[model samples]
Target: MKEELIVKAYEVAKERYAAIGMDTDKAMDALQKVQLSLHCWQADDVTGFESAGELTGGIQATGNYPGKARNIEELRQDVLKAASYIPGNHRLNLHEIYGDFGGQFVDRDQVEPKHFESWMQWAAEHNMKLDFNSTSFSHPKSGSLSLSNPDKSIRDFWIEHTKRCRAIAEEMGKRQGDPCIMNLWIHDGSKDITVNRMKYREILKNSLDEIFATEYKNMKDCVESKVFGIGLESYTVGSSDFYTAYGASHNKIVTLDTGHFHPTESVADKLSSLLLFIPEVMLHVSRPVRWDSDHVTIMNDDTLDLCKEIVRCDALDRVHIGLDYFDASINRIGAYVIGSRATQKCMLQALLEPLDTLRKYEANDQGFERLALLEEAKSLPWNAVWDMFCLKNNVPVGEEFIAEVEKYEAEVTSKRN
Candidate 1:
């Protein structure tokens, strides 16, 4: 009975979209090609298998949700469970600390590709690609500085760690037959004001050049910058300006974490500008309540605008999308499903936009028509089309997934504690 109603809703929606010179089928096809890289840290609150280090690097996941993955196998199981409800094939993003250490403490600099052999096998079995990040936080060596440290010995340690991470990403990419995007984000900055800003920035540039010296075929490099971290408030060594300039000069991808920018700043506004220079852009999608809280993403105005601009700029293919929020206060798997689906819904809404007609209105100088159509677009039956999408993908067609998540929690995660 519900299936008939869904098909009926879609038929009416198909006709409504067709009236605006839009094709629902085409929009769904475009969306189906997009693959979001789901971060692995969400399953375990950023506690990786490599160490028992406290979550640092100016980030915090504030929740004590039970049933968090306690081991590699458990994390993998939770990830698979979350992915089952989400439509389409998506990749998993792995932190350097999540390696299979086999209960042995392996320092970052001493890590190698062999440590992730099981991950490669696991990804191959699941038919998913992997993305990676070089973790520089929560370690004893990570004080106020790492790559940008004035101390050569400490700086060299981090440099070697990042270099080894790139090799590991290359191996994962080769095994998966896709380029692994390795993001380099350091926790190198000062809490109070610093006088030697240029000195630190120069040192960071040099360290990046050395770390990126070895070129690998299967791995791609991206540099992420932050506005400020919890303790590192006054000054950040790798500011957005620094990485933007660095990426353009070095021909590398620049990562834009939504929560990394100030609240007043609009990430959507930066895409067109960055697309003009950078090779490609990687998005670490997260919703920031006030500061860089890394709150789970929802279908809000900011996200809608961001995804809409990506489609409007005709740069969807040029931008790599990934989720980067962890909330331990709620059911971990439920958080994954909500955030991932919210992002997809936003993307779908953007895809369903009558872009051609709006562009024509702009070209013809029909200001009121453009504004009116833009406003009216919100009322379109995009939700119906979204239901159709979920139906076609064989996933739950809306609110239905809520029950599945609750069922999993009651039967599985609730028992973990």
Candidate 2:
């Protein structure tokens, strides 16, 4: 590791030691071990550490992660191995290896019941779990039955697929006794500003009803906060118009993508508000890049610090963490490797901070009100946290990225732009 990083690690360790009232020597020893583990895992590339290594280590592919262009078995192995990097503990609640909704266009039906059975066996060996979400049924070439067409046959086909997939998930979980969610998203929203909005409402309700009737009824149903496309339209799930439509006021929950909440609220505020409706958020943790660029960078200090605050408030147990990363610039393997490791590291640091901080508060004879006060004390701006981590890691933020962000000010930057 670089000398700067070593110093920074020591600083973090010293702060924790002081907070916990532990002897400096003991704190240093513990933090040193953590630091060394990080260095060994992330400092350099180890032999046989292929991006695909994640699955071989035992994680299962949950959703749209498989591509027509990739080998299913290979992708499955890489996902599992990526999961292995998570430190095991109830406190270390890194849920499942999550994938997006892109599989609608691919022929996943080829994997069949047999392939799922084999994969379940593989997951059992590694102690990993699988979680998945379906892409909007309306995407072109997704082969989704179109309720918009008002054809019963088309609608039935779509409903059948949903039911079959749910059954498959149930079967897998029954064997493994691990949790999984068959998440749903629909591209059903008015496209043209001049279009009749009522038509889209019918379409949305119909699709959701079909999903709700599936075999995965017992599993948690998560509605995504989308990044773009038709579903992001004014009446779509992520917009204000669809917020109520999302069943947010009901028992069903909504998932929050940290990067997706940009320009709306800082991650901390989003977490605070989101916790009210859905304690367990299906998170899409990635770097907040320019408009429409969901480049899967590791969690930065800004986001990590906010996530830490959320965890401190006991909001973590309510949510499951998913590495929702998709970056075409870097192949899937590189994206998964860097993004997964970075997220795990940030989670570790975030988890460690609060335990130490709370220990200090408790030892000081602080009451629960003081704990609330600690939350107030920890309420530093996201940018300040970002600066601290960047400084510690010697990570560079590019000027081009800054320029792209500036251009998005005052105007909505479309993905095409």
Candidate 3:
């Protein structure tokens, strides 16, 4: 991690890449410009400030790691600490339940932008932007279904909540001078076989139409889908096809969570198709072990493929990348650093690819050469470039961040009783 070593390695890497008709400086510049949205729930294990029941809706945070943020101040401190190790300035993704309700119960149906004024002030103070999500799980009304609930009363309650969420997102966007990406994901499904699938989807479509009835200038709306949840294995109301079709027809952005699909399903392959139709796409990058466990993301094949496809399609500006995982089993700050840095590494690798050369091989019908070049590209000195990026950003390079997280745990988080 020495300055001389970093500079020398980067020079060598630059030369090697230049030989392949790639520019390391341009790749580094592009990598630095891509801002990822860090999820807030990671600091507190999805246990928002709202006085809700245990985590439900087929989601659960599994560990009891100490030093978890007990309030907004502590959570902000933790996120800022995590950001220090990450490479670039990023936005924070907030859930409705994380609003500053002042210890008073503000039910989802009646929640408003006032509840999040403090967050907006805090984000502005830190020079950070924000994104929003409608909290549709772990509430008394979240049993069995939400927007697609059979009962009109239950469905209306969620509809109102979502409408208020969008309104809040708009205010945040206007305040920050950027469009807040408001993502709506509901765990509406059946634990057992249900015969009313069509009926539920129809209700969902109607609810979405009503929620999006009023357009705001500063917020962009996105709909997310999942394969299944813990108990909701029998049926997932918002499947991929449902959201893809709905997003296309309604002119809304579709969010693709990496862990929301089957293990064998290629999330990368879906990007090209979705990009052609949707105006934009949002990514909830997470690591799913055997199922949607929501483990912290790493530099694995799933993530690599996802980043590669995005670069291949030249969809850097068209896609919104956000980390979506909460592993309370480890140090929360470490989890954030690992996942965020790993994502950046994957993007750096993708950006360093000699796409022009590889594409030329494909265009010339040289399949074998194309395949060989890709294999060779894997062994390129992308790590040296990544180290330089961290150095330039004034963050710990390589495994040095591990010690920093430990130091914070001892000095800051461990004292929280």
lDDT by residue (1-417, candidate 2, tens digit) is 444554565566556545544343442233222210111111111111112233211111222322212333434444433333332311111111222222332233222344355556665776555554443242232332243334655555555555555665666656657556555544433333525555645665566667676435335666664434422334332343354345565455566666555455566555666666653556656566555424565657655666576556666556666545445442334344466446645654554453655666688887784578456534322223333333333333222223332343213212212
Off by over 4 Å in 1: none
Query: Which whole-number lDDT from 0 to 100 does residue 31 have in model 3?
Result: 93
Which model scores highest in lDDT?
3
Ten-residue segment with the worst summed lDDT in candidate 2? 36-45
- lDDT, candidate 2, at 78: 41
C-alpha displacement of 47 in model 3, angstroms? Answer: 0.6
Q: Alpha carbon lDDT of residue 186, candidate 1?
A: 92
TM-score of each: 0.99, 0.61, 0.99
Query: Model 2 residue 157 lDDT?
Result: 52
- Superposed on all Cα atoms, model 2 deviates from the true structure by an RMSD in Å of 11.6
lDDT at 18, model 2: 53
